[model samples]
Target: MGALALLAGCGLPRSGPTRGEIFNGSVLREGDAFVLVVTDRVNAIASVAPALGFSSEFRDAGLVGSDIISPGDVLGLTIWENVSDGLLVPTGQNATVLEEVQVDGQGFIYVPYAGRIRAAGNTPERVRQIITDRLGDQTPDPQVQVRRVAGDGATVSVVGAVGAQGIYAIERPTRTLSQMLARAGGVAVDPEIARVTVTRGGHTGSVWFEDLYEPGHDIALRNNDRVIVEADTRAFTAIGATGAQSRVNFESQSISAIEAIAQVGGLNPSLADPEGVFVLRNEPEEIAEQLTGQDLVGTQRIVYLLDLTRPNGLFFARDFAVRDGDTIYVTEAPFTRINKAVSALTGTLGGVNAVSSAAQQIAGN
Candidate 1:
């Protein structure tokens, strides 16, 4: 008993929050700042949900043709005059050979009789009309054909962790973000855990690869749009009496607390306190009071308690969003500690009794 008492009192205490302290609602400290916000599903989602905000480059704009031309593109122009004595061509020549014309920096292409026409910001068909209209006065009803020789001006760049990384020309009528990704051989990592970012004009938005298949996810790509697929390294740490205590990477974009608990090996039946499943997180100081009643001063470490003993606790765990860098802890139950102490005492007494019995037998012998 004495040895057990000494053993229990000595050594270091458990390096984690207790069930009682967290259930009572308290603030965890770190350095000299208040950052934790332990709360229920409503508060937790509100506090950390904003980080998931991704502004999409493709908004409600429906699918659009990718035939919009830009400067530096090469255009093939062929002019055909029905009359044998064409004014634009020679007296005997009825057609002009295909002319390879490069759209200048000013978005203009020069033609023999059409003069310099705006072709950079217009589609190939639109440029053909412009050339035909210009040559109408020179030649009687000139039939003009404009073909895109090379796609050097308008292209979508696919960079980052993908099988094929390069600029893909958007020559189709409607080129979608998914099409560009497919052109790049999809993402190198798993689609569920990968993040795809689309930058168009001045707006940029990101979505998980799993969301790429969702409705409205296959947005149309614009000229000069950049699609970057990056590996998702976001993760959360699980400690205490869970199944396994270690950092677990986010297999998906987001996971519920119930799934997170299962990933950490679930609660340890022998040592976990059913009423003290806690999630520790750091939140913005502005919404601290609204989240929890605890008057947190520094390191606003919030300890959210989930009582698995209650009927609604397990149900609500599914709604809780496990944020990145969150700490999922299952505190040790009170009886668990008592059992350890009692087992030590029982072993010590059993050894003493065995020795005494051996001595008595030896004396009799």
Candidate 2:
């Protein structure tokens, strides 16, 4: 019987989350800062703050900056004149100057009578002051007002195996990358963290979600930006005496052998040959060819193996992460295969004897 057929006979159910869940959960709660820092040794700018309970007005303390601006933003402006009632009244019957006016490609907004005004790099209050100064001669004591239509235009892309994979818009001016991910829905049940790429201006960049929980390692976002959450579609082939021997979907870019086994509910306790377990990967020649063609090898296209019986194997199990398109084979013990063959032969001999005896009795009658 084929490996798949053998697996079907075992009646194994679906697999669930394992240690990978802890990493993914951490990413959703904190961010990708720590993971990046550990893997690449890069420094992040933002710091993680304690969660403020039941305080709606308190913004995430991680957000820092005196006055910063981004592109593709909108603003609302209201001009008022002092009134006898002590409440600010509209300068004219129509007090609103601009409503939801978008910033231009050059990061400038065209104001009425004020001509082209730079708004991209300036704060809302500063922009209002600039406009007020420009119109000082036209009105006597003109009170100007300005506010962001959409604040802190940092965005992160969500691609791959997700319910919704695309660019998610973030309105928090000081929100970190980790905060942006929560806004985009946490990683799917089977997440490939290594395959998760963060690109800036069409160039590849890295973010450390783990560091977000640490003191200082969170990075801020910019407007018109993108965050792609992609599902790692890599296929991992499982062979040998496992419960279900078939190709399992690896949601993340890297998966250790132990984790892979757990994903398939570990080796079937009754049938698995723990000592002979092996993972067959692409040959070095094959990898070199694939990489030369498109540079898709290296971390993204490597495979590994694990032996559960060895005590020290656990260390390698965690460190030897699997790459996309990896194959894991668990060889059955010699006795198991021999026993199956002997049982089949015995059953065949019994069936033949019964047929011969029945034929002779019919002929004699």
Candidate 3:
């Protein structure tokens, strides 16, 4: 009995440290800065639940019109007159073809005789009417036709983590966020963890790439809008008595504590203590004040304790949210140490018995 007790006290093979040992190691030089919190309904309510969403301006922005022209657009104009000697065209030509007429930066396009006219804010049909009216007195019943050529006037820049990066025009088919992304050859990273950010006129909004197709998320695009697709960088460290001990990236936009544990293959069933699942994080000063009664100077070192034996323990875990950079540690069961010690002692006794039997046989011989 004494030998077994001594073996257990000296230290036996363990998957991880015990709950009491973890608490003992948490002490700091300044004081007991580590605040241990019991996971409950009250604490779960105060836990951080972070999510990405767009504001009203991002969601309520109007769609870009299909036929609208901008300053950087290219226009093709064909002019015809009733008489043989047309005003803008040559006498023998009957009709004049003006190819690749680029609209200037100030929204003006200079026709040969029509002078500078605004074409940026008007549709191709509207520009045609304006040009016909401009030559009405001199040309006598002039017929003008305006055709829009390819240009970057109403284009949005698609860059970062996409299969292809370029400036894509916001046509009728590619007016929404999802359509624009598809036009850019789609995201290169995993859709489960990809993030899409839209920056328009200095206003920025973001959403999970998986949620882009959802309702109210596929927002309308605008001219010169910058669409950036980036892979999620949020992750947490899993250590101690869990199945895996590595940094697990967030597989979804939001994950609860229970889901995070399952991502790491759950706690080690044979060695884990049901009541010793812990999450270690440095809580912000404001949030720490809410959790603890003290107004901390900087980030407070928090150790959130989760006891799975209680009636509402599972519910608490389901409600508690796990943030990025958090370290999830599960302590070993108390009896696991004693069991390992007993196994070691049993093996030692068996070896001793075998040696003694061999000595007796040799002596008898």
Candidate 4:
């Protein structure tokens, strides 16, 4: 029995004290709910201050305001003349007044009478005024109008774990980040909420989904902007005597080992060795070896064992957070494994006898 217990312990996972686990136990034991310390390094970036901007306090950058018009936008212009019968007439002999104009690569639109006029970066009303002024000498009371035709100039690219991934044209000038996501068909049906990354010119910025959804925290989209919705790459594998031995996606930045087990529907009570729960983590050297394919000298594998038999262990379970791709395994009790082995041996013998009898009958026939 002693030898069996030793084998069970060795086979079981190893658990060690974590920084947060130690801190929690120490601080809570002192009966202090609040603790403050002045340090040069602060975690202010994760916290968001709505009054200032939509960006988190920890983020060095601010939220993008609104999208502006750029060059190469197709604009539709129509000139109408008030006629005698309250009907608008085209100034041209063809009786066609409306003319669709394209803003050139240099942000200039050409009119019939007026030469190349710059319309890009100007509002519709501003463009209309500029057109009116330019054609003042040609016709009396020249009424010019300008409207956006093609939206190629103002576009946002949506990529990553969304239903649709591509560059979307922003019909409206003032398009928000949330609206752009909706146009991209939303995020995947996973715990990982979509992260929006906006790249403009050569500068890039990122914002979390929660920040965009929460009230008073709205980020604007810009023209010629690129929004990449990256897929959730991090995952946690739950194995051993769990209800479901599967890999659960690590959506949040942090997750406890117990929570990871619960994600797979917890451990199988009948076969689980509560005292032998273990978490297998790849050491830094192992990860480096796997990544670079070079043999790492003195590489050590890390295995954390947790004994869930004690009530105090529950506190550690909450504090011991698991990293992405970490494996959570609840080992089967020694007795259970023995029983399974015996059953497998018996089943194998019975199957062999049945096969042998069938072979003999065939040979006799």
The Cα local distance difference test for each model comes to 0.74, 0.54, 0.83, 0.61
Per-residue C-alpha lDDT of model 1 across residues 96-208, encoded as one tens digit per residue: 76657888888887887678888875788888888888889877889988888876546889999999999887767327877778878989998777889888778888887
Extract clashing residue pairs from model 4. Answer: 13-305, 14-304, 14-305, 15-304, 15-305, 45-58, 159-229, 160-229
Ranking by TM-score: 3, 1, 4, 2
TM-score on alpha carbons, each prediction: 0.73, 0.51, 0.74, 0.52
TM-score for candidate 3, residues paired by index: 0.74
- Predicted candidate 4 versus true structure: per-residue lDDT over 164-186, tens digit per residue: 88887665533777787877787
Of candidate 4, the 10-residue stretch with the lowest lDDT total is: 38-47
Off by over 4 Å in 3: 1-17, 24-34, 39-48, 70-72, 80-87, 91-95, 104-108, 117-122, 129-143, 156-168, 181-194, 201-203, 213-215, 224-233, 339-365
Q: Which candidate do you rate higher for lDDT, 2 or 3?
A: 3
Candidate 3 positional error at 243, Å:
2.7
Question: Which candidate ranks first by lDDT, i.e. highest?
Answer: 3
On residues 45-161, what C-alpha lDDT tens digit does candidate 2 reach at each position?
111112212121222334533344556878887876444322234444535456777888788887776678988867787898898887665555668888877755444566644
The TM-score between candidate 1 and the true structure equals 0.73
Residue-pair clashes per prediction, in order, are 12, 34, 0, 8
| Residue 21 in model 2: lDDT | 31
